[model samples]
Structure formats: structure tokens, C-alpha cells
Target: MAYVFLAVAIVSEVLATVSLKLSEGFSRLGPSVLVCVGYAVAFVMLSQALVRGLGVSLAYGTWSAAGVALVALIGAGFLGERLSGIQIGGIVLVIGGVLALELGAEHGP
Candidate 1:
């Protein structure tokens, strides 16, 4: 399904971004390779989703919002990153906005 491809795209993008952080400015070989491969796979999957009839606006908005939220959680939980209350609120807003976008798309012509 298109949604499945979208999910893969989102998760791949998130992993790519996290791997980029772990890549140490590209000095690390393993994570650097992962970053490159992950992003490539993500874009391909995203393209597949688009080709499968997911609206561009809805798909991109949801993908990016979910990626941001998931990356923030991973950063805070495993990467020793600090998240302020404002950042947390922003994440919640991003999620709410994505939900609103999905709901609107569902009800729209």
C-alpha cells in the first residue's frame, strides 16, 4: 500500500538523519555509508508512495512532521540531547498539525 511505502520512507529518512549525526562530519565510514544508503532508500520509497496516489501535500507534510518528532525523541533518549519544554510543545504541535492535515485530506474533495 501507499501508506506502507510512506511509512518506510519516513523511518528511512529518520534513520538517515540520525546516522548523519553519528557520521562525525563524514569521518566515520560505517555511519556515513548508512546515511547515504538510508536517504537513497527513503527517497525511492517516497517516490513510490507518490506514484501510488498519495497527495503530495499530505504525504510530504506527514512524512516531515513525523520524522521531526521521531528524531527528536531519539535524540533525547539515546543521543544525550536536551529538549526544552518549548521544543516538546513544538513537537506536539507538529504532530497535531499532521493529524489535522490527514483529517482534512480525508474529508476533502
Candidate 2:
């Protein structure tokens, strides 16, 4: 389903972004390779979802919002990064905005 592909796209993009930090300015081989491969797979899955009738804005917005949330959680839990209430609220707003965009978009152009 397109939803599955979209989910994969989101998760891969998030993983790719996090791995980017671990890539150490492109000096690290393993994480750099992971960054490249994960992004490539993400884009491919996104393209598949687009072909399956999801709007690009909707798909990308949701993907980006969810990616931020997941990355934040991963950072806090695994990397010992800290998050303030404001940051959490902002992330929540991003998610709500994505949902609004999807629900409000015109079905036909």
C-alpha cells in the first residue's frame, strides 16, 4: 500500500538524517554509506507513494514532521539529548499542520 511505502520513506529519511550526524562531515565510512543508501531508498519509496495517488506536499510534509519527532525521541533516548516543553509543542504543531494540509487539500485539480 501507499501508506506502507510512505511510512518506509519517512523512517528511512529520518534514519538517513540521523546517520548524517554520525557521518562526521563525510569522514566516516560506515555511517556515510548508511546515509547515502537510506536517503536513496527513501526517495525511491516516496516516488512509489506518489505514483500511488498521495499528494507530494502531503506526503513530504507528513514525512518531514514525523521524521523530526522520531529523530527527537531517538536523540533524547539514545544520544542523551535534551528536549524542552517548547520543542515538544513545536513538534506537535508540525504534526498537526501536516494532518491539516492532507485533510484540506482538494482531491481533484
Q: Which candidate is the best by TM-score?
A: 1
What C-alpha lDDT, on a 0 to 100 scale, does residue 34 get in candidate 1? 90
Q: Write the per-residue lDDT of candidate 2 for residues 1-109, one digit (tens) a residue.
A: 9989999999899889889989999899999998999999999999999999888998889788989999999988887899999999999999999988877785543
Which sections of candidate 2 miss by over 4 Å? Answer: 106-109
Model 1 C-alpha lDDT per residue in residues 1-109, reported as the tens digit of each score: 9999999999999999999999999999999999999999999999999999998988899899999999999999999999999999999998899888889878986
Candidates in order have lDDT scores of 0.95, 0.91
Pairs in clash, predicted candidate 1: none
lDDT assessment of candidate 1: 0.95
Off by over 4 Å in 1: none
Cα error, residue 81 of model 2, in Å, equals 1.3
